[model samples]
Target: MGTATHDGAESTAGDEELVVSANARFFRALGDPTRIAIIQLLLARPHTVSELINELDVPQSRVSNHLACLRWCRFVETERKGRQVLYSISDPRIRDLLHLATRMAGDNLEHLAASQRTGPDWL
Candidate 1:
């Protein structure tokens, strides 16, 4: 028993509603381009904050902020190597997930780029 929202998207009822909410939060965490780039880099190999800053060519604060969100969402994990901390994807399945999303987004590039419902501001 789900009800349609104003946007015509079905809102789950009962226990499933909690799951749907969680799924939204998870996707929101990954919705960021910076975060996606960080994940892509980590998929190749772990890197320290400084290294990420250098590679991403973004401000240290920005990279750290995104890393914090990714860490909070359990999308990433960190390990201390002496004085340096290495950040990496927490699970191997993330590679598959990113690959699938890449394909789907590529296939819908035209539609995705034109959609006003989910614009650049959504990020």
Candidate 2:
């Protein structure tokens, strides 16, 4: 009975490790700029890889690479239609994050411009 209990504890530990590793990978995938752009574009609507390539104005290889990362992270989902895959954000939290990022960017830009007008030396 003790041996069985020990094995169960070890199994639980292993499951936790897997969960943490998966979470780490997900955040690491989101750290890329191209991946963030791809996610933001997808928030509007689903699009084929070719559409993303044109919209992002990036190379096909780069877009495809980022899409793969997003898919792995489970932040985006893909649907198969013949040879093409349509991609879109799978999580609503991503849309909230995008809005928050936009607001932060606008606020930062305004602060930067205001500081520049006042001159850094004056402060």
Which has the greatest lDDT? Answer: 1
- C-alpha RMSD values across all candidates: 5.9, 9.2
Q: How many backbone clashes does every candidate have?
A: 0, 0
Residue-wise C-alpha lDDT for candidate 1, range 1-123, written one tens digit per residue: 788877787776764678788999999898778999999999999999999999999999999999999999999999999999999999989899988887989878788757878755764
Backbone clash pairs for candidate 2 read: none
Work out candidate 1's RMSD over C-alphas: 5.9
* Model 2 RMSD, rounded to 1 decimal: 9.2
TM-score (all chains, Cα) for each model: 0.81, 0.64
Question: How do the residues 1-120 of candidate 2 rate in per-residue lDDT, one tens digit apiece?
Answer: 212334465345666678699887766677566898898889889999999999999999999888887887788899999998899889989888768767877858666545544443
lDDT (CA) per prediction: 0.91, 0.80
Q: How close is candidate 2 to the true structure, as a TM-score?
A: 0.64
Scored by lDDT, model 2 comes in at: 0.80
